[model samples]
Target: MKVMRLPGLAFILLLQGCNISAPAPGPDFPTSEMADIVFYNGTVITMNEDYPEGQAIAIKGKKILGVGTSLQALATANRTTQLIDLKGKTIMPGIVDAHTHVFNDRDRFGLDLPGAQELLFKNGITSLGNLFCTEEFVAEMRAFEPLLKVKTSLFLTKTFPCGEIQDSWYHGYPATRTPGEVLRINGIKITADGGTCGGMAVSEEFIPGTTGLGDLWHTQDEINAMVLEADKAGYQVAIHAIGDRAIEQAQNAIAYALDGRPNVLRHRIEHNSAIRPDLIPRYSEFGIIPVIFGWKKICDFYPRSPFYEAADFPYRTLIDYDPDLPVAWHGDDPYRGPVNPFIELHSMVTRTEVSETGALCTPPSWLAAQTIPVQTALKLMTLNAAYSLFRDDETGSLQTGKYADLIVLSANPLTIDPQDIHGIEVQLTMANGEIVYRLPASGL
Candidate 1:
């Protein structure tokens, strides 16, 4: 009404005051009511007896929602779903390296070799039990978990750089009452000695006195205290004890801490190289898991270097005591080893050297008995390794409700000759329902 000749902006503001807000769109529904991804026409080795081999699988979010015949899975298929036609490839639970040092090396040198990760992935290792990791390295691994698609356990150390002592041969230093106290922290790694180096002629180079290195690393009292602290805090301890002396010390430490405890805590002894035949029974008695590095045949013992020792009984005695004692194989790579579990598995079953000359020299009959069956060896890398780390319930098998951690392989290891196991290539690796490594078309 010509009252004040309202400006255009003023009139629009007045009109806005009378407008009503429209109701929010109904909960922004998923674009399509179907699985985000599906794999079909594949031999899905679910690792579950009920559906061991399936024609297809469906995943939603980070879990395997469905596994069955391809026709059964097609009901949930949609145009938006990323369908993977496997063309009869073999699918198995992602391999787990029960004993590895990915984070440990990365922490020490900030080095990540493509060859190492590729070897592991190509051989189907999705999870690694990292022995000898510092808290700093553990933290870095936690940060990189999503990217690496590798799960890890902390192996606390009680040596220097982070602790005190070099090779555990010194004797005169004043013993702190709280010695090894810091080792109670998560991801602590402790070593009894410098592995086989203590037994070699070069033992003096690493540790001045070969015999005392074991005692000097940590006293019985010191190890017990650290183990008790770790036990109370719900942490598993992994000890690097390759020699018999170190193994005995580790066994004693575990028994001391676990006394009168109802829960059988998981404890691991890294390498278990040159284990005393008598001490084999002590592993099960103390409930200690031995994470053996199978690649040692090619990586160390066969090299015939200063550290080479032909007498080292990798697992014969231990297997005699308890075949089901839960052992896992590892490839301690980037330090004279390859990350391929298949190579290690082959070595375990065949006990043949990777080098042609060594393999030729070894008796063909003996090589056959050394390695475990294909299925059992697979368990060592998956279920047994998970059991060693106390993470079996979460992973270690391709079961519903478990994390969708698995790998697609070119062929079934069980169907092929154990010697030809290395030929099987990992086509795809998935962790948490997400593809992490996809094989290139060239198959390199």
Candidate 2:
């Protein structure tokens, strides 16, 4: 199997942003046209504003031919078409785990990407972006590509593409001049600050008065040089900045990179937990994406450092800025957290930890100011993530001519009570128009 590069197809699709205009197909039910697969009798949430809601989807090979009414999809089918009755199930684009970590020890971690992919199918994840990895992981991903059921992209740890530099002031960019690591290496990741929850998330504000601004890995000048060199060498950059002040440093580096050059492939800020409300506008002005993580686990009602006075994960600010601000959400798990994306999504929408018995696990009014609507949260799970990777056109939503990567859920997250959203089960998951995982028919 060939080693695919990072975000090979999805990056091209990101250029379209949130706009694509197309007229609806003429009213027709069961026209007898040929299709490889036709899913009907289901609620199709395309996530695309042009066609916000759909009834069915028709697929020919890996790509989707059309998304419309159940009768319309059925009409496009023929004798060879694999007609699947969803039985009023809710179908939406597969969840995209935008930020993730597979291993703590990058040198040696015999993790199973194939098995991980299967389990993700059960969770309705058909696309994943591995924000932390090494060259070894790249080779392993290529070896496992034959067994993978989901589309993926990976970013090499800072050390993978370039090792430590001699001069403490000079940034050591990757040796590759043309960014040979395009598909295999999504970008180079660097830590501008530390953690947010009492950890080392470098910031100007200290905890009350103790003066613990966490730690800064590199000076702003050093970061600027590093990003500039990488941009010239042709690799995108992702900087980990949890604190508001740290986010500023990351933004400066991205701005330096874009000086006189175009930002075609998106540069990102990782784990932007304490996003300064003022910097929120810069995200749109600078064309920078945010790969959000840990919001589901900690931001709900946890003890964040008292140094920060604003909303912790200002997702609402990002969404309100552009509605398509390249803000992608993730768990950053298997490295620092759990692998449950839905659990994260649940926490994201509800902003509270609910127990298995459907009880609230935390205080009710802890972080209400940061709560966003379910509609915006769904984009965080799908299209925004795809846009972050520049793959929105290929797989994020149920758009005409897009990949048929979708999932069927037991309940719709939109209409159901927000408290019950996490409990919704994934009845089926499909990638590239092929059924990758399906619940037992009896259970369905």
Candidate 3:
């Protein structure tokens, strides 16, 4: 071409690496001075009765320093502190997914899917309980701890390979590990029966193998030994029991393990989907927490089988039996449901059926009677989830001296329609006082 100048090309390359006209920096705060990040002009749901709907909050170094009116909170703010005006947005403690498979899937499929993480954070989820994971993955997660803002706890699953049956160890279980260490770990998650493939209702064929009537994973003797070993090691057993037979077996296991130990760590039956009405009281009597799936009755179970039609979901039956037994709703997500708690809440409150056929149906009576209040539901995700992991004192609520894990929502969940609850966006997510996710102005 017309004698392209080499100097011009070099200048263009240099310009690409540097901005010739840089914007002035924002006001800087002194590093030596005490720093506090304050948020004002927002409806703050404290979850605590003392301070409900406050105008401002002040946080410093992984803890909430104070929560009060805008003027009161401002008293602690100095020139060194950073300030944010929420413009009347709604703010609440970070959303917690009581039951999740984040780390499980991450380890299974080595991929960082931002969309999956964003789906949880953008919809108000800030903390998660990785209900099931391999010890190897947990060690790996501990290494990159800072980037994963969400609090995570590992629960060991006694699967075929990792567990010993008749002196033979399962494949996944490390051969070098001692039995004591394995039992000392959190819970052991074991699958009772195959879902969908096993008939909609519990039957002999549904049991592990074609034989139809025996222990699904291990013999009763082996299960008893495992449960007792775990119990002695200060571990609470969390079993995945979905069918009626599975529920009965799980209940029996808890009863056997806690025979003499009163008020032992609350054993949890994950996805208590099909329960005999008589067994409802067993959950409370034995200090077993039933983590029910809210989305199951409305969306998952209804379409898949006739069981939904045969019996009313028995939501009222369970709550009426044990009001204080710690019944919490959960979405066993990315498996069959969305990770959005609001979506689970909406379905629970309305009992609105969403079909795979794209048809919508509502139960005869508003399931609201059986549904726990929004505040209680919030606790299920936070306090209850933390309690499940035996880490309540360290996290769960937004309080002084606790980790500053929280999320800023776009709207007040209590005042808005339950259906619109899921629509609320997470404006900001902070874990340990560090901003992890900030929503763009466009709300993308």
Candidate 4:
């Protein structure tokens, strides 16, 4: 080889000519943003419209960092990051049971508050709406808020047992809409009528066996005044209405509160078990949320109910009328045993009783027509329910910047037969980026 070495300056000039330069004393390579925990190798049903499905998700502090594939999520993992291999299992946003009287479980059934919360976590519920809160209950929850894992939204009641007006216990607690809080007082609750006691306030006569039309706990004017007062005080109002007459009254009261215009307060009609077709459109027109019982069609109360002739639990009718209407679900725990969302999902999907023998307790044809799909049932339990609580932006779905409230399942509910959905187990549950519940190490 010929001895032809160029000088440093000449070499630099040559490199420049080749479109190359000393990687200009570049800035230091930054550290990769790491996740506190990364769940990979599993199906992820992110209810988020932008990222509807994924195979993995990454969590930072208390919120989701990202949701995509295993490689994408794992890219953010460091040595200290807890990498959970789902191993063909499934992950989705945690269940948000919009309504349940679990405090009644504590007082009436002797289930301690912590135990009730554990039960809720085990069932994959990350958030819940405790529909009936008295002053005593509010104080208990305030004391327990620090230790709370499942997010709580309490609706203070003006009446006990859903009837008989008492002092304004709700006046003690302010309506709270702060996102990511463990506990919040969402609104006030009232009963327009009674369902199980043959006082559901029906326009028509009850079935031949029952004596007369159902009873209304409060007259239309009285309910309107109460709802208006609550609305004025910046609190959403939840009214229990089961018969056509009660449903109509509830719609009217909500309309009166909103001055016949739609608003975002999401005032709700709890139960809404029986509604005439004429009243269904009002729910959408007035921005009224129908928090109907998910398993009512198959429950003991539905088949033997006195209210007839009215469209009972007309879920399909309501949804078909307004696809965008927010229809949430409630179990009304303690009154309904097993208080499990999966059972409710199964019932809503199949419109049948939760029978132990697997024999179908077929509902009436009209009731069967109300059956919704599994996806809609899930949304009713999670996102739509969150909307009812005004928490949809905070924790309903697995979206970036939202609380890391999610659950792991043994199987995919979407892939399984609808009848078998209730059997799906919550292998693990994460609330606010912390593991609140997990299956035993032995896989029991």
Candidate 5:
């Protein structure tokens, strides 16, 4: 029940990143000569440049002991070790969702932390960014930390219903400073514009008939100060900007805060739903991460207006503009889409809607041109998302010395037909060497 709660254990592990030289096993690391788990006889997608694909992986305690051939992995296992034959299944790093509102409105969703864990884990999500947190929410997370199996990075809300920056809430939170903690505060979330219900700030009218340009919650000067203050205080800022005007304003503020240079802070423009072609380059120019919605294209959550002009949910344009651009995907769960990454992935790859109710919405013809390859969509959901949370080096990939966060799938996403991707199911989910969720044997 008490998982990896050793004194200074987490702090020592925090010292590691993407370039793991060697395993720094703790004094009480469960086993000294034998691995706790050895998964072999399966296709392993390490996602590491060193070992792009492997046949097996070994885990000692919470750290990945080694990643290589099936023989190499089995060498570390003993009779006592839990040696799992994957039976030709596919295993890869657990899906990391960079942005979601999983914890919000739990009552309406009939969910709690345990329920949230089951929901996320079943979908192969081991890590997430829970935006729009309040002090009360943070407190609830801390109290429920023991029950949390999914890693959470929170972005505290600066105002009521995601508006009006509040300086008082920015200070006095220490445990939230790191990335891989059960619950950590990565930064503050500010709603620069509205979404879904139509307050998105835009230069052109979205609703045709009315003179609706949408709403801008804060002026340029106001957002600039808010971002700069959070940046100086050493917090990543995630702003919810749904429209072109709001996107531009967020870019401008980020540019000013970072002195017009590429930023390492990873300040994000969440739900970059509607953007102009001209604003595409600013993501790479300012190093601002575009946290886009993958399923937005398929859903009629927002009307497909005539004034769209290749401006709504332009993920492909933003991604192809710069090879190094860090474009991440979000589901905005329990709000617009489900937490299932495949639903999002299906939308990104097919440019078609996979609704929660099993109904399909006809996508705009322009959406087809915006579809990305399966590989690109996976990165957006995993590594790129981890990078956005400043946790790429720590947990994104299944590299040696990193936490053993991985999942087993019924089928491989890489080899399957694009149309059949959404059908792939997560057979097993593991986080930090712990098997968090698993389906019945017959389910596979």
Candidate 6:
């Protein structure tokens, strides 16, 4: 049999570095034609610094062609192209979760992949990082990705149960492997200490629950060695620190690791709650990202404490200290948090929660100062989240030449009441310029 010449779509995939399957583009191929799809007449949040708003957007296969006025964008399309009239709807970049936990077996942990897919797509969470995973688990998930709707970024761990590395792998982890663009291998996530509400935040402040001196699994030297080893292996370190003491330890270790070289890879603090006000600057100084869980409103894990104001979350303090300090949000599901982006968004801005049956969420008047602006809250689930996963350049915003990963919202959360933000629904969800999920009434 004679070998056939590769088609335009095959060549396109090779150029884009995407390994997934794709149908062949038409015979005209690349430059001969314009865009594959054009969406116009919408209130588009471009999310680009230069062009922050647009009336339309055009796409070519897996990449975004351009964003501009309806006339400007539509001019690039031909009769063969598919044009979608947004009817004044709101379109923004797809949501991302910086940190979360999931199991290998969907049945285990009562993990419902299909249900979770629908739940996330409906809420506009297009990409998420499973912060709890081993090489074995990520490989299984990667194999099962085609069957799922959402994109994944996996953070592989070298040490779990908060200890030293052995045998070049964790006790129960599989062999090491390189990661792809989407299946990102963001260094190790180690538990430096315990939770806050448990009175184990490693703080000097005492609590009824237990001794405030939380568990420090590794000393600064141990953490430094781990960071050095991980960095050498092409990975960043993510430490799970809550209390001031634990956060300090993490800072020292990371600082030592970054001693002689510039920090090109990102380091992070997972669940960075209960950090003292003075310790906040060190995070930005060290370029350590804090993957904050905004769904703390749903858990009493950080219930009213005399030591809560300056320590618990301290989102306001951090952003105020340095607005440029990158922070991202998470749902932290099946592990003491809600998996709803809306809930996280609302909670981050309102510092409140819905009732058990849902609805009837009231912002405690006393804690009103803790709330952040709507725009700031939106970044927690979008740009900042993607930045933490090193996928910001690809899917964080509605920018030209980026992947057309975006969502159509029923309403713009920026102008609406923060309390009502969680009520917003995703009218449509598109990943890689292709409609992946749409409401039945949408007629897509």
Q: Highest lDDT, which number?
A: 4
Which parts of model 6 have CA positions greater than 4 angstroms off?
A: 1-33, 102-105, 108-118, 145-149, 161-167, 170-180, 196-199, 205-212, 298-303, 359-367
Query: What is the C-alpha lDDT profile of model 2 across 254-356, one tens digit per residue?
Result: 9878984557768888888777667888887888888886234443333555434454676766777787576888767665444556667677787776544
Question: What lDDT would each prediction earn against the true structure?
Answer: 0.60, 0.68, 0.59, 0.78, 0.78, 0.69
Question: Looking at candidate 1, what is the lDDT of residue 32?
Answer: 33
Per residue, candidate 4 scores C-alpha lDDT tens digits across 343-404 of: 78888888876754445577877777888888888899899998999999998888778899
Enumerate residue pairs that collide in model 1. 155-188, 156-188, 156-189, 156-190, 157-188, 157-189, 157-190, 158-190, 348-371, 349-371
Candidate 6 at residue 114, lDDT?
65
Ranking by lDDT: 4, 5, 6, 2, 1, 3
State which candidate, 3 or 4, has the greater lDDT: 4
Poorest 10 consecutive residues by lDDT, candidate 6: 20-29
- Name the lDDT of candidate 2: 0.68
For 356-433, candidate 5 gives per-residue lDDT tens digits of 787766576787778888878888888889888877876878877788899999888888887778778888999989
Count of clashes, each model: 10, 12, 3, 0, 2, 1
User: RMSD to native for every prediction?
Assistant: 14.4, 9.3, 12.1, 9.6, 7.9, 8.5
- Model 5 misplaced stretches (Cα beyond 4 Å): 1-33, 174-180, 196-198, 297-307, 360-362, 442-444
The C-alpha stretches of model 1 lying farther than 4 A from their native spots are 1-34, 49-51, 106-123, 142-148, 160-187, 200-216, 298-311, 314-317, 356-368, 442-444
**Candidate 2 TM-score, C-alpha based:** 0.82
What ranges in model 3 sit over 4 Å off?
A: 1-35, 49-53, 107-110, 113-119, 160-185, 196-220, 297-313, 353-361, 364-369, 442-444
lDDT (Cα, tens digit) per residue for candidate 1, span 1-444: 222322332244336451111222111123233567777666677656455566667777776767665544444555576767676687788887776665466433345644345555555776676665544554665565444555555554456422253332212221211211211122344666454343311222233333343332567787777767666655666776766666777778888888855436676777776665567788877668888866544423222223213225446546656887888776765453555666666666656546423342242332234556667777777888877766676667776556777888878887877677755777788877878788888231
